[model samples]
Target chain A: MPLISQQQKAVILMADDDADDRYLVQVAFEENDIQCELLFVEDGSEVFDFLMGQGKHEEKGSKIPNLILLDLNMPKKDGKQVLQEIKALPAYHHIPVVIFTTSKSPEDVRQLYKMGASSFISKPSSFDKLSEVVRNIGTYWVETTMLP
Target chain B: MRKQTLQFLYASLAAAVLLLLSIGVFTFRSLRSLIEQSDAIAHTNKVLFQTEEVISTMKDAEIGQRGFILTHDSSFLKPYVDATQYLGRQLKLVDSLTNFRPQVVQRQRVRRLFYFAQQRDAHIKQLLAASLEPNRPDYDLRLIALLNRGKATMDSARIVVDSLQQTEKLLLEERIHHKDQLSANTLGLFTLISLLAVLMFSLAFYLLIQEIRRRQNYERQLEKTVSDLLRTNQDLEQFTYVVSHHLQEPLRKLQTFSTRLVQKHAIELGDNARFLMERMGSTANQMQTLMADLLVYTGLGLHGDTTDFEVQDLAVVFQKTVENHEKQLSAAKAMVQFDKQSWPVLGEMEQLELLFSHLLQNSLKFVVENQRPHISVHTFVITGEQMPFATQSQHDERFVKIVFTDNGIGIDMQYQDKVFGLFQRLHTADNYPGTGVGLAVCKRIVKRHNGYIHLAATEVGAAFHIYLPLAN
Candidate 1:
């Protein structure tokens, strides 16, 4: 088990097909005071590639993300398939995968959790609430939980 | 209603069948008895005819013997001999026919006739013999005496025969009367059976027509209900699609631009400008939450399919729900106690999880000031009859009763009825932070699972009771 050190910044890999949502989430993260490396992917397949150190992610070296933020509705492949694939692999199963989507549907949240998602957070429409949510996620997952 | 109609139809059909069967049996018996009575009357008439024939044949024999005595002709003797033979056979026949009757007077009269007939024949024979003997000097006188004696015997025999004939005639008349009575009774019975059958058939037909009309009424009602459901579903689908796609996108952009403006021009803007920006951001957030909840509410209406449901363990679903609300639970310092023995219910796993999550969220949100929320989830099995608001036609015989109780600010009795309504809130946003659709979503989910959920009146805190079908 690989433990994240307090001094080191954790990397959060995000997969979302929406450009505006990705940019807004990045801005929300910037507005918050959480110190973490943010990596973005436009599709679910890219999420798998980043996790496996394949394609464009190969040049970045063997740097696995400490956490994965997934979007439910993505082009090429959906977040549900990615979550299933990530949880099925023994090497990546221990990494926390949080579903961050615009869907506040309880069924989607429950389904993501049942599929081994670590957390499900609905994307807030406002920037301030989004920043607060990102800050809370950082505090809970990074500072409070002992991530492997 | 349909079941009741079908039961009534079956009952009437059975009654009609039974009535027809009884009528058939009764008519058959009556007709058979009538035929038997007619046969008895015919037999009695035959006996009367034979009795008269016996009397006439004896008289003929006596006449032929007298003829022979007067003319001294053997041809007359031949006729007498033939008549006597015929008379003997006829008397035997009459005796045989009368033997089966229980009438003692008839038997006695027949016996007297037989004896007198024998005496008449003897006298005739004696007269013939005396005439034939030429040596006898007083043959004519002897012949006359024999003739007179024969006549007296013949008269006695005729009188006996007449009595026998009278008895036979009376028997024949009585038999005819009995036959007529039997025929009339058979006809009456047949008429009664026909009338009863007609009445029963008419009653059955009337009941059948009523049942058909009732069924048609039910069909019409069902068609109206189905059409109304279809229209509502279509409207919900359109609403959900619009809310999720068209409505939320602009709201998201509003929040994004407002935050960017505050971030880039915080120094350039006045102090109140930041406050206004923050308010705008929160308002957008609130609207987004409301829209999301509305979308979920509308999505629940698309529950026409139930094939996706399976036997799911409540414990697992509860665990997922607790996990979903982990942030709030920890923030509120809520303690949730669940039973160890899991209940298996027939439902969609995701929907059940959502339902419990909403209940837990409500418990956490409605806590009294400065108090840690305490929520307990327990389950038991109950019959449909035990539920207060269950429909009589509920298909499930037994249900798993899941009770969720919390030590939170209780709902007033007056507000309990309106709590499950969409967007209905008992408290302001300052007291509790929610979209007010949590309970409504729970109710919708329960309904989708063919279950019942309601708030139980409590003095201390809110309690919700959910009744779901137990898996077979």
Candidate 2:
């Protein structure tokens, strides 16, 4: 129940199909001075492989993520399906999932929340604002609250 | 028109048909009775003619008897014998004709007349036999007595025949009068039935034509409505596409590049250059928020799924709204109190949640600078009479009234009407941070649920009253 502490490195897994989005998010976190081990996947399928230690991620072993950031638009599999599959499994349900996408639709936000997303953050267009959003997330999720 | 109206028309048509059938039956019965009365009259007249024939035959027989009594000759006796033969055949014809008369008294009179004729014939024969007797010394007296008896019998027969004729004549007159009256009655009934049938037919035809016109008008109106809806849908789709793609995509690149310029080149650039980049980034960010809010506003204009509606608990919706604004509520030290046992309303849950969230956010955003906001939510059932605006035909429906009263800077009465207008804002961005579409979105959401939302006059902070139909 304690905060994630500066000594313990928190592993954050992010799944996005867009290379630009993945790079911008990494830069945003760096701008915010967030100290965490960030992992990346190109699509929803890779997210699953990373979580279950399957396919190319099998040699990496099962390293449970403290939080997962998912994008709604992806190839092969979408974020909604991955979120549903992750929530349906009792073994992976404890990992906090945050929906990070460009869509600010109320329906998408409501549906993601109903599907057990811990938070819904609209992907900011500006890196400065994205840095602020990332700083806030790190402060709230990593520095302020306990992660399972 | 409607199914019930059509059914009523069919029922009326059936009733009219039944009425016409009954009238036909009645008219036929009346005509038959009239014909029967005419037949009776004709029978009475025939009986009258047969009685006259019998009376005339008796007169001939009396004449022949007198002639034979006076002459005492065979030639005169020949006339008497022919009279007797003709009398038997005439009497038989009279008897058959009289049988057709309706009255028993006429039949009896005919029988008495036949008896008188037979008596007369017997007296004639007696008179002739006496005259033929040559040795009889009292022949003259017997002949004279027989002649007197024959005359008395013929007179009696004439009186009976006269009475029978008089009765037949009276019956004939009575029957004629009855037949005439029946004919007049039947004519009158036929006229009335024809008038009634014509009136019913006219009414039915008029109703059918009116119904057809009404249905045609309804179809035209429906077609117009459908076309208007299609056009509006096309406009909304275009708007959505532009907002999502063309509008946001460029703005996203603008903000991204502005932020990158400020982040990577801030050391090489002067203070003013860095400020411009920062301002560019902030402005792009503001525009993005505006576009997002606009998307939501326009999205509401899109036709919603009608099947998404269900009976939803207002308390649950309120809970979700509170949870969504938890951070803001805690930061402002705001308190939102409401009855836990709120009434259930018929609506889409997500839309209702958004509606409540906007209202709650309004209260949170428009508070006094140093004061903690206190928002009290009250719910109760209300009739149409309690509504501030005019209600048409929904007066009988029960509405769940939800009132959100806050202890913040209240809106002026003049601006209350404009608060729900799209993109209408009373405060500057520096004073209050909002896209000025929160209340408008709430209004759209409420309207989607067939409900109403309005700003009630308040002395302290803002008060919003939302009226939603209670689930029956």
The candidate maximizing DockQ is 2
Pairs that collide, model 1 = none
Predicted candidate 1 versus true structure: per-residue lDDT over B107-162, tens digit per residue: 88889888888887788778778889857888768877887888788778778877
- Interface RMSD over true interface Cα atoms for each candidate: 1.8, 1.7
Q: Candidate 2 at residue A20, lDDT? A: 75
The numbered model that scores best in lDDT is: 2
- How many clashes in each structure? 0, 0
Query: Model 2 chain B, TM?
Result: 0.63
Q: How do the predictions measure up, each by TM-score?
A: 0.60, 0.59
> What TM-score does candidate 2 reach?
0.59
User: What is the C-alpha DockQ of each candidate?
Assistant: 0.36, 0.42
